[model samples]
Target: MDKDLNSIVQKALLGDKKALESVVEEVKDLIYNLSLKMLLFPEDAQDATQEILVRIITHLSTFQGKSTFKTWVYKVATNYLLTEKSKKDRKAKEVSFDEYANQIDTGQSAMIRYTNNEGEIGLLEEEVKVSCTHGLLHCLNPANRLIYVLGDVLDLNSKEAAEILEITPSSFRKQLSRSRERIKNFLTAKCGLVNPNNSCRCKRKIDFLIDSKMIDPHALRFANHTKRSIDMMQKIEFLDKTLSVFRSVPIIGAPNGIMKEVRQTINSITF
Candidate 1:
């Protein structure tokens, strides 16, 4: 944390209402984005974000400042998400290699292709890239998912991630390596975008998705209305180039109005 943020934390812990409000405003996006990635649904993300903000406020005094406030906040957010994942109805879809391969087979000799002149193809590809990559995360257990998110998606170092996860650095690295290997093997064996042997194409899925009423072009939830696209390629450039496909995918952020409400709820509190 910078000196300015450190000062805000001190004031917030000391019962400065404005400072507390400022803290909420400053970290709202971080909390919301993390929750959105973990929960993978807008409504669930909204609820998790609100709960996380309240937890941060409620536990502000327990912060020892041995680590940066941002690190502490991430630890809190991770613990909550892991706990929520353990609850019933939160079980992630398990995709076996056979099942994954079945989804990638185009059936016919040629896979469907779309032209850029229509404009909708680009939007569809954007959605496919984001959704497909995020979907892959769900195939892993919650612990492995957290490791992948912290180590690869969010690009935190092993030491930092281990600290946040409260695990040994070696243990964190081992889990992260296994998670990467599992995802890489699956992608290489199945996804055409990642491997030449695979025939699956995002363009082909667009028609099926639209016909099935899974995606509405009129109101695209993941790809539109954002100031900037979350290009994981640019963000994770420091990683191995062979795993660039995962890095090229995007992670959607929280929708609008959530931040304002969360901040208000935090500011209204006496603490």
Candidate 2:
């Protein structure tokens, strides 16, 4: 931790509103991106962002600063999100998949293909765009998405994120793997972008853009496999026997019930 970080946190903990705001600004992107990836919806991401900051304010006094300030801050955010996830219903009504699909029409696809280079900075076309949302971020589920955001976007290692989320490193790896598998399958199947087998580079992405058709077989297979897998995973006898490690411990930051009020909350808080 930088020496000055301690001072900032100390002031924030003491209710210096500016100090608290500064802290919020410092970690805003991390919180927003993590929320976006985990919830896979724009509105949810916005809500999570606001809720996280409010949580930080509520818990600021309790922050002991034992570890790096960033880690400690993240730990608080993770705990708050986990608490929200365990709830039965959400503040915002859950959006049906049908409603979401209706928004991502083919005309939007043509626009995105020509405009956003999938949000990669240098890869953006000659004319830049104001990103309306994390369009691709919503492609994740609660389980696997965190790992991708923490590891890939934020550049945090598995161990650090695990520490923040309070899960074992191995569980982190498994979740990350599952998250990647699901996303890779989704991109290939849904948007028809990304072919993992053909080459390491994203040549397959172009194929999807050019062909304008869904050619991914795994999407069909996944649709079939998901139901049985969920049922099988729920059966204590088998799920416990196989997923012994991930089963026993409390899921430090299980998904936030993947909610809807999520949008309202984010819009309220994010700077």
Q: Who wins the TM-score comparison?
A: 1
Give the per-residue lDDT digits (tens) of candidate 1, residues 62-85: 999999888899999988888853
RMSD of 2: 14.0
How far residue 126's Cα lies from its native spot in candidate 2, in Å, is 12
* TM of each candidate vs. truth: 0.84, 0.51
Model 1: which residue pairs collide? Answer: 233-247
Model 1 regions lying over 4 Å from their true place = 88-92, 106-117, 225-242, 249-253
Residue 105, model 1, lDDT: 57
Candidate 2 has its poorest 10 consecutive residues by lDDT at: 124-133
| lDDT score, candidate 2 | 0.47
Per-residue alpha-carbon lDDT of candidate 2 for residues 1-271, written as tens digits (9 for 90 to 100): 3567677878766656576666665666667656544554445656676777667766666777667878886776666555674262253233333443343332232233433444331232101110111234344543344566675446578889888877898888788777555444443434311232322122223233234433232222112211222222245453212231112211123134432343343335433
How many pairs in model 1 have backbone atoms within 3 A of each other, for residues 3 or more apart or on separate chains, i.e. clashes? 1
